[model samples]
Target: MTKQITDDLAQALWETLLLHSTKGRLRYGDITAIACEFGLTTKAVTRVWKKGIRSMGDRVAAVVKAGWSRRGRKKSLQSQTRPRTTEDLIEESVMLEIMKCGGSNTYKIPHQHKDKLRNAGKLPTTLPCDVQA
Candidate 1:
């Protein structure tokens, strides 16, 4: 069974991250140390750290999917990050269909402007990333 990241733990982690943030960002070294202090993987802690920063940058609430899934035989970082709902899947499909019709559009998906995507209904209002690039 995969360990679940409870709201309380996530909240605590967020607060801890906030305290350690320098100009709204923490160094990766700091992230590793925080993870050690919290008895969590560095990736997990970093996931939370980046998300909080991104949310603030976007002027929205900080949110992330911070738990693992049980279906997978092995627990990998990718699986830990992608926890999707039916509605999310539907939205993604719609977005792909729209993108297919986007003639000569070659924007990198990850780096694309989210507001434009959201305005075009290609992405959801709230985007929770596992890691901030």
Candidate 2:
């Protein structure tokens, strides 16, 4: 009568089978030899081979389904860097205009003059006096 293969024997033989299969040199005789060496039935050896094949198939299927490895933390909004917007550009130009105006008290400049500077891309959104620099 044939003996049942132990877990350790199955694992060892499965690893050996993987090595041989990768080399394209696996055969039924190889399994039979392993079974004989480990005192297991040929059926037991084949069962382990089937289990290994199934495990590999499951892994391949999972990766194929996801299209990539879905591991680790996802990207955060804080980590994302967006391109400068039109509003940001306008604000920067306004600040540059204020600096170019001799750094004098912005409150002293008339609203119409400030508006002209703003149209010329030389005014900040708010005067330095209006808000703390």
Candidate 3:
């Protein structure tokens, strides 16, 4: 499993690499020494070193760009705001009571429900649970 280092640790790692690197390239011995100092695997230290300066810069840039999103509830799409389930599609509360009698309502709701929902541009696959209707 990959280790999850905090931002501070990541920055410190980047700075340590910068100090040890010559022309953004770290020699094998330097990598091993840095890894031992940070208690990280030599492979992990070498992988970051191989990504060159851009990857190192990203570690610092992440701090500068942090908290811009201000974590909160994600915005809901208009069509997705309400449930699209068959039960939820039948908006009229009385429809549930009527549907409970049998497969579909006796007179108007069962007959017209699907057609009304269809013409109103609802998904045909999302028609009410009364398949017999």
TM-score of 2: 0.38
Find the 10 residues in a row with the least total lDDT in model 2.
60-69
The predicted structure with the larger TM-score, 1 or 2, is: 1
Expressed as tens digits, the lDDT of each residue in 8-123 for candidate 3 is 66567767888877876677688778888888887776655554465456774423122225568888799866554555445543465466665455634544465566559764
Q: Candidate 1, TM-score vs. the true structure?
A: 0.44
How far is each candidate from the true structure, as Cα RMSD in Å?
19.9, 16.3, 8.6
lDDT accuracy of residue 80 in candidate 3: 63
Q: What is the TM-score of each candidate against the true structure?
A: 0.44, 0.38, 0.44
Question: Which pairs clash in the backbone of model 3?
Answer: none
Clashing pairs in 1: none
Per-residue lDDT tens digits for candidate 1, residues 1-133, read: 1245766787789989888888886766888788778888877777777777888789998765455544468756985663444355455555554465564455343444555655576866444433221
Candidate 3 has its poorest 10 consecutive residues by lDDT at: 60-69
The best candidate in terms of lDDT:
1
lDDT of 2 by residue, 1-133 (tens): 5654555556677777776675434675888887777777877767777777776767742111211235577776954754334465455555655666666646232333555665587755443443434
